[model samples]
Target: MKTFQTVRGKLSGQILLWVLLAMSTTVYGQQSPITISGTITESGSGMPVAGASVFIENTSFGAVSDFDGNYSLNAQLENKDYTLIASYLGFTTQRITISITGDDLEKDIVLAEDLLSLDEVVVTGTGTGANRRSLGNAVASVKSKDLTNNGATQVDQAIAGKVSGALVQQNSGDPAGGISIRLRGASTISGSSDPLYIVDGIIISNSSNELIDLGGNSQNRLADLNPNDIDKIEIIKGAAAAAIYGSRASNGVVQIFTKKGKSGEPKFTFMTNVRLNELRKKIDYNTVPLAWEVATDRNNLATVEVERYDLQDAIFDTGFGLENYFSVNGGNEKTSYFLSASHLDNEGIVQNTDFKRYGFKANLTQKAFDWLDITGGFNYVRSISNDVPNGGINSAYGAITGFLFSDNSIDPTPDESGVYPVTSPLVARTNPMEAVDRFDFNQKTNRVITSIA
Candidate 1:
């Protein structure tokens, strides 16, 4: 009886100890994790600062504040005291010593204004510009140096391959040809897809008016504006631009800012440049001395010996271009003025094809009152071109068409009488030498643009 009582007492004590151990482990597993939470506010007005970053120093634990300036971080802290940091844009960063033990800690951080922070100013299609950091749309800006570095005389040529999602296409190989731009692909099938152009807040025409047809080739009026006079260019595309510019900006918007006078003594600048344009590749022509005889009946044809002539060298030549630009600018605290002039001459690869342009510009600004300023701008351009038919379908007088459709047996060199013989009688019915030498086509334009604000 004594042995049985001792065994029962020992078993009951062992069960009681195991029950206490399990209960202690359950309590430990149910304990909540430590968390650090805080609200970030401005120092002066105590306004909640959203999008602020709150983090623990030297650790990967961090969180961003919500719209209400509330933030929470789960910290598996190994140290007794940790350094909490809060940082925001245009605001001074704050750091404080924090302690996390067995309970959650609440911290409220105040960020002071960073007086030295300067945001970039960006043109947002509005009269008053906005900060670049605060804008949500994509806006690309190109400086004058970047636009003119590639020896470009025309504005379209200067912007080629410099902007994102902007495609520039030359319609013809003529020195004074038109350019087509597609900002967001073909937005409309029948309507014009060209982007709206604004120069110094004034809408300008970019139409390609062809007074005479040169095989469907025309000149864009935008070429009249010299690239040297540009200060910068801003491009805005997609729905963001349409909301501000309406249906006219369905394709995009291009804003050009001309150079303005600086507040200093008079400054003069002179620049001259020369460029060369050459053919990329030549077509491989068959130089064999044998060809199929031109028999009226194909079944009764015979091989005939002939002299194959190569006319590519005679049709194309190295092009030359020359440009001169001059400018003077000056201003005081109350008044400023800028004046510039430029001249350009370009020769095309085809013989007797050339382009010339003369441009002048003036900009003036006056401060009438402490809070008001008046500005005005004037621009003039004269363009002349010796054009040729180099584009579109098979026209008998087309420079390139006549050469491509001509026979290798027919020579393009003029005879002792200085008369060019027909090269393709059945097809183009014109000779390449005649088109390049005798065909005279001319185009001239005089335009003036003015703006006041």
Candidate 2:
């Protein structure tokens, strides 16, 4: 009787725990989602303003204005009063406060052009700053809008083609590989041709860091920077333009400004993107068999015509990539804060090649006293990639040689067991498909940038 009573008590306790969990879930789910519908238009023209950013304060609920300047956002009815903000690239930001009640809400916003863009403040090579109109020097400033417009996975990629006189080329097709940025032309034959990169008044290295097995593959450190965290960039393309930075700026100078908190209610933003990479051009191969091209059967020693294999197509395939970012910027009269985090996963067109990165940043500023202002920031990034080897005749495992050396008759397709059998006698290198899948070339790095002033 005592044992039975103990067992019954344990069973009853487990049942009670489940019942409480279900009850809490029911109560939480009871909160209905509120829908906010609105149309955005230009103030002067009364025309639709599409692609405007609309969001609720301090929450992940947001939507973009459609082509017709119409937008609708669903917000959870957790807060009694919510602040909604609408922003556009060339217009002033608009904010409205409201309380969520029973159901749907309607709001229409009008934005006026910001003339201040003409006289935008610009930081120069010298310690002094001036507006764009006053400055006589030739300087290129890239802002947040330009960076995010193309959805660049790497910060350097965003500047490519966008900056005039800049010749930016990625070293390899590998997503995480190095980038070659040449300003104007090479200034010196011996010195480093790469420009000097400065972020938040500190110099950052952009040298290639290649390891073993990867051969010539290298990753430029600048590729590690998260594009979303940047607010603006100033590029001094020529050596003369970077005179203030001294000799180290021989290659030119690139100054990066990180995003800072603005004085307003807390605001939240989330962005996601997906991209596909396809092989547009393939090497044309001779489909017909070459005369006198014959191979002997291993078992019978009988000569047989070679079978053609489209190794190029088998080696290349469609690639996909994904990116996600979240940020919150807000502050009060004296204190301000900006926090952001992002993740990227890029799959390369070549098999077994991939790049992944994670980034986080936090900036805080406080006006402790009238003359004593303080600022601090923390940044972190983690990168991972498979450094696949390139094709070359010198390398025993060169992937390219597997296609060139083998006769067209040899089949390179993988079998049911996912193995590429090396059946040809002429091929000295490992099967290209097998080599990429088997080789273990990986790159990983963790970096942190912090400041306090």
Measured by TM-score, the strongest candidate is 1
Number of backbone clashes in candidate 2? 4
Residue pairs with clashing backbones, model 2: 306-409, 307-409, 308-408, 308-409
The residue-by-residue lDDT of candidate 1 on 322-436, one tens digit each, is 9999999988657889999999999987778889999999999887875566899999999999987873464557777777777778778889999888887667556877778
> In model 2, which runs have C-alpha deviations exceeding 4 angstroms?
1-121, 130-137, 188-191, 291-304, 392-396, 401-407, 413-430
lDDT score for residue 338 of model 2 = 100
Residue 133 of model 1 has an lDDT of 61
Alpha-carbon lDDT, every model: 0.82, 0.78
Candidate 2 lDDT for residue 360: 92
lDDT of 2 by residue, 174-227 (tens): 778777888868777787688888888788888755656454467888877898
TM-score to true structure, per model: 0.71, 0.67
Worst 10 residues of 2 by lDDT: 290-299
